[model samples]
Target: MRPARTTVATAVAAVAALTAVTGCADKTDAASGGKGGPAVHVTAKDDSCAVSTASFAAGHVQLAVENQGSRVTEVELLFPDGRIATERENLGPGTRATVTAEVKAGTYNIACIPGMKGQGIRKKVTVTGGTAERRDPAKDAAVDAYRAYAQAQADATLPKVKTFTDAVRAGDIPAARKAFAPSRVGWERTEPVAESFGDIDPKTDTRADGLEDGQKWTGWHALEKQLWQDKKLSADSKALADQLDKDLADWQQRVGRAEITPTSMANGAKELLDEVATNKITGEEDRYSHTDLSDFQANVDGAQKAYELLKPVARKNDPALSAELDKQFAAIDTLLAKYHDSHSSDGFVAYTKVAPAQRKQLSDGVNALAEPLSKLAAAVVK
Candidate 1:
């Protein structure tokens, strides 16, 4: 790999296999439903699920999610294998939205994606008297594609992390800083799957500012603080770097076992865009190192990879959406490329170098891509 400063920082693993999630087409809802079921009204507070009822008769049920919190939020019906029966995204405060879905006689969860980020909060809901279709992992080409994509990301991540950690352990602060943002690219792209694993996500990705009172801040942000803010590394910093490498290696083993599906690929793509809108484009994340642009490019690349894998399925299921996504992804890619590094064709300019107007252009591009991506989950879950 090129030296950190010379690397273009695109997650190279994506393009090679992004096309693998092709041809698992026929996903249909063949489940039997009882008489039309009742509407279940749900209230999403900042951190709570105030459900009108936790039990319902299994049939065509209506789910209404009202966002009572300050930040934007969404609601999803969690099915096994990462399938979402129905979901509503980006509902603002005091707003309500609903989705009609065929539900079966089984226990399900009302997943509240508060602030439209993180793992989301889940509330259990049960239904009775009808049957639900079970998803076969074996038949899901998209899931296979997703698992492979994750493995690629992990494999890509370890070496980058090792480079960064080695720099830190060697007390080479400048070299470590140069390597930091690029190293985080793969993991950030695979976040939809990575964050699902217990504890590891928080341990590795949590923002120093977002840490709970008692939480020991680790991961990229912790290291970012030391490298960019403190501007030096000590023995404890070396240990932190080593721990990050170890954690990523351990997490790579869990990548293959991750739940990947057409629905997951679609949702993960949308969520990665959310990360861009929520943080990266704002220049908030890499405040210390000014590496936000690299991360921004990485996030976009990650989302595009997922979109690429699901494109064939989406085209079969919903051609209009597929076309729109195609256009949006292409436009965003072009806009981002304007910031490409002169020295490294694959790398981009420093985040600090981006002008305010160009930043808006990038943000607008991301928002445009996000709108189409938001519709992807519903379109590909055929």
Candidate 2:
């Protein structure tokens, strides 16, 4: 099973609106009026979630998050509707990080998830004053372009998934296997956007072991296992196929409604590279089919699309970073092409055929790209 790319950011944002409990203490401090934007300090302990300030002037804000708890924690800035304004996860005890986001005047939540699980400790926050956004045309263009790309990926995925599911329903193992990797290309490319919708990624993409207790195994990987690992299709397999189709359709319909911003696009691009480094490069994502390279390429494709759209602003703000990103991206692309297979189901050699040394090279390339990619959010916001 894949090392559960279970994005808690995706899950909490999805559930917060419907089930979020009301009324926690608001920790307020004097809003920062100096350079580098307002600073909101967040402390996450096993038993309590605390913030230095809960109310502040709206605009660009830096959430300085610290985990004082034994367990690793996640902290999020959420809109009233449960959309993520920004979030940081895997904060081990005594560690700290800063999350930057653009927020408008509205009500919001600062949620701290100890152990990076559940709805988290919630505190209501109020944003006073009007938009403090920089009126940059390049920033607006970047957001618009990335949103359109994300929507297009979602639209393309539904039909491909439908074809894969159709083969599953027919119990045609060979045909289903052929369709599997191609079907996932779009989803892998725009995963962070799809994941933003709550529970959708879990429903459609979770591996067997990735499931929570009592959660049914469904969607692409569930069927992949049935086809390649189990080598038999039961009535349950057909039923799973139908459910997968429905979930993907829901994703397509809702992707257009996702809240996108320049910083989110930049952050999301880095998230895709992280997906490759931790999961795809390990060949854990497509364990049964051994088609990990397809997913790897798709993740790169998505990350590159976001980076390209944000490039004008990013290049202007940090040309050196932009040049390095270009070099690393091209290096990875060249490395992947060595595994290309024109006649294969996913247009790449099976992951099982990728030698250990080759996999290490791939891993190194992703890490190389990811370092500079992480700076994208801050660069574009400038």
Best by TM-score: 2
In model 2, the worst 10-residue window by lDDT is: 17-26
Candidate 2 lDDT, 1-382, residue by residue in tens: 1234345653332222111110011121324422355678888999898988779877767676777887667788888877677776555567665556777888999999886556789999999895565578888888887888888988888888888889988888899999999999989999878777656888888876567778888888888888889899877988998998899898889888888888778777876876776567666688898999999999999999999998998899999999999999999999999999999979999999999888878877877787778677778876
Error of 1 at 13 (Å): 32
TM-score of 2: 0.86
Where does candidate 2 stray beyond 4 Å? Answer: 1-35, 70-72, 92-95
lDDT of 2 at 69: 88
Candidate 2's error at 84, in angstroms? 2.6
Model 1 alpha-carbon miss at residue 102, Å: 11
Model 2, C-alpha of 80: deviation from truth (Å): 2.2
Hey, what RMSD does candidate 2 come out at?
7.1
